[model samples]
Target chain A: MITRLSWVSLLVIMASFRFTVDPSFYPSARSATQAPKEGLAYVAGLYVGTGVNKPDFIATVDVDPGSPTYSKIISRLELPNTGDELHHFGWNACSSVLCPNGKPSLERRYLIVPGLRSSRIYVVDTKPDPRRPTLAKTIEADRVVGRAGYTRLHTVYCGPDAIYVSALGDAKGEGPGGIVVLDHYSLDVLGRWEVDRGDQYFAYDFWWNLPNEVMVTSEWGVPNTIEGGLKPEHLRDGYGNKLHFWDMRRRKHLSCITLGDDYRMALELRPFHDPTKLMGYANMVVSIRDLSSSIWLWFQEDGKWAAEKVLEIPAQPLESGLPEILKPFKAVPPLVTDIDLSLDDRFLYVSLWGIGEVRQYDVSDPFRPRLTGKVELGGIYHRMRHPSGAELTGGPQMLEVSRDGGRLYVTNSLYSSWDNQFYPEGIRGWMVKLDVGSGGGLSVDERFLVDFEDARAHQVRLQGGDASSDSYCFP
Target chain B: MIYEALSALIGVFAGVDPSRGWLYAAYYRTFRGDKWFSASLVVVVLSTTTTTLLTVAPALIALRTHFYTGFLLLAYGVNTLIHGALKAAYPRAHYSGPLKPKLTHLAIWSTINSTLSGYGLPLGALTLIQAGSQPYFYLAYVPVVTALATASLFRGVAHARSLTLNYDLILSALYVAVGAYSILYSLSTILR
Candidate 1:
């Protein structure tokens, strides 16, 4: 009788296991918007300006203003090797797992961090103590190169079934860059994601609408052209000016819409948070024709996928203090390196990395984006200072919005090599918080500045699921 | 062969009480005269067979690839848990119905009844047969399903009603066990 009772008790315990899932996983974008403000932010700090061959580390900062260690780095997870150049890392499984066709029982616990320079991938377990994430497994560069046949990993986006990492080039650091699929659980490099190339080559950022079964991938130059920093000849000759659309489920390229050669280096892709919406925003970094940046809204028109240029930020003429790259142009281009949409899908934040400004637009109307607020901190010429009277080095590059859309975290590094070309004085990375008003505006928080003296800060991810971390199935 | 037989037997037993209740409603309460009795029985058999065929492709595809099979089983577990919770929350209502014998309504009701009575388990059993690459094993369900329909048609309405409450309690317990086991099995395969 005791043995039978023990078996029944054990069965009950096993049944309860199905209910176990990460609480951070929300079912809808609106649900994520209702989530509480995040208390911590994970910032990737690079050892570019420190003049040392030290490995880069991910720093966990306490963003909760009420906490004792608020505005402080609580813990750090350093990589094993140098020159990894950790750019954009993501959760292995996010709210995407809640998607209808999405895989269940996969927890959003591991952080998939890929090295842009090293071509390696590290799976960091954020469980037990999220503050101090520990490295669980590392896939060497040779394995990724051998399996995926691609190199120079750039963006890491967690899909419903697998972890998708977009590569910047082929094995030899050339054209035809594409995405590589990694197993969600094992972090194993599965293979190249693309079935048919279909003239789509240069890849930077890729995102999808799950319910609609459509994926949009934007492009930049390959490792060969990009690693040496933006060149005039490469800008004219090699940089990609097209946005490719794909059948996400079939892994087949559907169509390619070129934004014309005038608009070069279409870098970042931010699709609409709602899975049903077949529209998204992509940032074109610095048009060589006018040294201006433009944001294109790609959506389904009639039947075929199309794009319309919605907003443009022209270059600002500077009489003095121009970097060598900008001296010929005599203007600071609004190199909009990154753009993030609020979870509520109300406001769109543009990071003008070149002119030292972050612009907030009310994209409640996708086509007609009204510039609601703009703040300047660091530029090639102006070099604006913070409200706290502290000197700033680089302009806002990576933007991470809190789930509630009440606050925005801005980091000031683009790429280690590119940082040197733009900010010749060397970027002493710093992350600053901006207090967002209820309607639409930005104000710098005087007390919340994380000063990484020599380490250049790149992408910042919020503690739980952030606005950019997830894709939802429900409206 | 024994495994397939056991699976079919479980489906048959789980399906018996509801099938009998449906038969009682159609034969005695709703369609009392004419050829209505013959038509209602056909609807019951048709709906259950339709669901079985519809689910067979997904089950077969899942069997061929363990990745999808793991997720499919997990989905079944989650779906079962949800149904169990809903059942526990709202106890079964013993409705004699208005007994309006309309064809369209009969079709819908019979389909819903078949689904609720664990006809989906035939798809699970079919997946096992298909895994062994024996497509002919599916023929075994035809006679078994027909026998169940004919046997239930003769059951007295009083006896069908009397067995319901007890049958529901047993079914609820079965759901919990099946849901738990499905989740456990899928998790073991995927997480391992």
Candidate 2:
């Protein structure tokens, strides 16, 4: 028999463990002119930056923004691997005029999508309307390298009439890198670039410096084990982080940026995106692992980039009088994924795709980022672990900030099998929108929830591990 | 100058994980479910609690502490691995759903164990450098070592017969107590 006090304590314990995720901006069903009100389906599921198979699941959401309020599965922009699992999705400007302010030109909002399982690119044109949002035309993911074998696609973005993809050269000597380009309008394969042939170890990340110049950041040849520790040898034999610069005009590799020997955050090219160029040491936090997930500066003053490791974004924010923890439960938090920055360069949003949390930093100064805001997305009744029986994580992936700073978009989904294991509800994704109108403080817009309906297409609760963990959708 | 080439090589290499390690790790963590794992996980917790005043200090609050709170994760991870290995070998361990809360408890404990001193993680990725790497040559020791380790852990579970319902309740209570303690400890740490 439990005492009344003990029962009360038990209730408190259960209550604390039970997390409630509410969206403050649940866009009330407003008229088409009123922008998504509650129930108007936001984004279905987030494309955690797809590769080869589907590239990106990015499609146009054509809601009337004023009508029915609840967006129907009315129409979806069909992707190359339309029904397949896409790794992620990205958007770039249509033309220079659209990006007149130097923001990713939205003139022709380009979709960056690739099939991770299959080497293919997904270039899509999207028109956003509450009533009807979908792809204009479907373009085949042309061959980036001679053979897309082992190699795959991960991220895609658009630039002045051109689309750039972040791919890996998995095919031995064929290419350790690849970025296929296509004519935006014709969707025809313009040209393909591959350097370090068969370099299948190409990490996943890319960014465009200018209209015709793009930077590709990826893991060249380091092997990391999930639910495990790092490779001592790979750490020593590390193939430094690369920031390859490409000459879009000639569709060739122009130059590259190397961070000597350091793991780089798949990045977004902003003003101070260059680690070697200007000394724009603004206050910002770039967490490396759990111990440093809440960190400020990744580089400690290399005379070129940042000068000190001032800020910290640890897996657990308890140090700052906060009861937060990074993913993995033990050890340290891995790298923060789905990282993006606001166009104004004022806010930098990073998702702990591991322990469901998205933190916003005031990069008013890239070096010393002020911990502007943080949103903790929790509720893992059954903490997610890996198939091998390691770590628990429920990744809050990828963040995209609007140009005007009026809104911020975020997706909660799992990237790897470990994520699925940790958070079986991972496949059941959500695209959350935060109204930054409150300024630096990011608040959730609860009005609507973008439920990736296809998440549960299959069953078995995904066995809670890996891509093979057949859930209802792709079961 | 050469860093550019090196970066390219490393990026391409580390990006070939295929999410396999994560899958294996997840299975090992949640094997059949978390309930059973939570039971033994309680044993490990009680062992620690008996010795450390901190463990009994403020159960709930303590969960927020660094080293102390880790126990929750260790129990969970080790349980999953043990169960996964058992099921993989015997292939007849059937169970139903609605066993998440217990599984969560198991996950926390196992993570704690791994961080403390289990080669379970490293043994699983002796070759992995980052996440994805092409060709897949480096990480050979992971599967072999994990099989051996899980085999040994499975034998231990077999030795104990099977986890019981009463055991689950005790385990739950103990860990919850530990978490409460850890949260309080974290507050103190911050204040200090």
TM-score of each: 0.74, 0.47
Predicted candidate 1 versus true structure: per-residue lDDT over A281-316, tens digit per residue: 999987878999999999999999889999989999
lDDT of 1: 0.75
Q: Which tens-of-lDDT digit does each residue in A97-135 have in candidate 2?
A: 122111110133334455554455555444455234455
Highest-TM-score candidate: 1
Real contacts recovered, all predictions? 0.00, 0.01
Q: After superposition, how far is residue A355 of candidate 2 from its true place, in Å?
A: 2.6
**TM-score evaluated only on chain B, model 2:** 0.23
